[model samples]
Target: MRFSGESGNVTSGIPFGLASALSQAGSVLVAAPVMLDGADLISATFVRSLAGSLSLLLTVVLSTERKAQIRSMPMPIARQVFSSAVIGTGLGMTLQLYAPSGGPVGVVSALTATTPLVILPLIWFFGKAHPPGLAWVGAICAVAGVALIVNAG
Candidate 1:
């Protein structure tokens, strides 16, 4: 998730931060029309899935380096991706599609956003990788960010 400047210095923050922003935006974009106009959730999800699949296909087809890397991906990594697709994209989105735009749903939605924060400690406590302190700080901040968005009004 690191990016490089013209000087090739790594600029971190692409993994969680970028993906979180995009996920929030994508949900709003998809949810708005569905909530307002009574659009079909299955159709919306299917279209989003098709577009995402096409984008990935294009990335793999267009970039030899990316294709090579994906081709060489280990079984464990592939399994992780498969599970994520099933749980995160499939089941999660199906549930989210039924959620209202506001009320208690927002709180529940925000709490789910804290999964990484919760996972970080479990991973550390289990003797896995000793993640950087800043990573924990970032996860904490992300969890706290829910306060900023939730409105009692």
Candidate 2:
């Protein structure tokens, strides 16, 4: 399946970078139980989701500037928001919930780093754009690095 970039524009690494930051923050919370062995995964996930929902709701309810900006956007904005929610908040969260943390940090970190490989190819295929040879080489290196880390674990 083809993937649409943010705001239906070209795929820049910006969205991926933002996703990495957000995922890192969420993983910090998720990894607590793995390291401590007391907290339940369900509880941790509930806390994460609840906190996110509340923050979003609060922003929508309180930020007049943001609300106005959103309101001023075109009708297609709903579609954009819906698409992001479905892919990001829905499927993305499910995957994070299922990713195991019982292994070496390096292994988990390496595996998590493979996202760009899959996404870049999907983006290129969907957009019919070809990246430079170095990009392809880097992608291969990323895969190989992940393999080494996992094997070492």
Top candidate by lDDT: 1
Model 2: lDDT of residue 68:
82
Predictions in order: lDDT: 0.66, 0.65
Give, for candidate 1, the lowest lDDT window spanning 10 residues: 1-10
Error of 1 at 125 (Å): 6.7
lDDT of 1 by residue, 21-105 (tens): 6766566555765655777777766666666667668757987977888899999889988997877766666556556554355
Compared with the true structure, model 1 gives a TM-score of: 0.65
TM-score of each: 0.65, 0.53
In candidate 2, which residue pairs get closer than 3 Å at backbone N, Cα or C atoms, i.e. clash? none
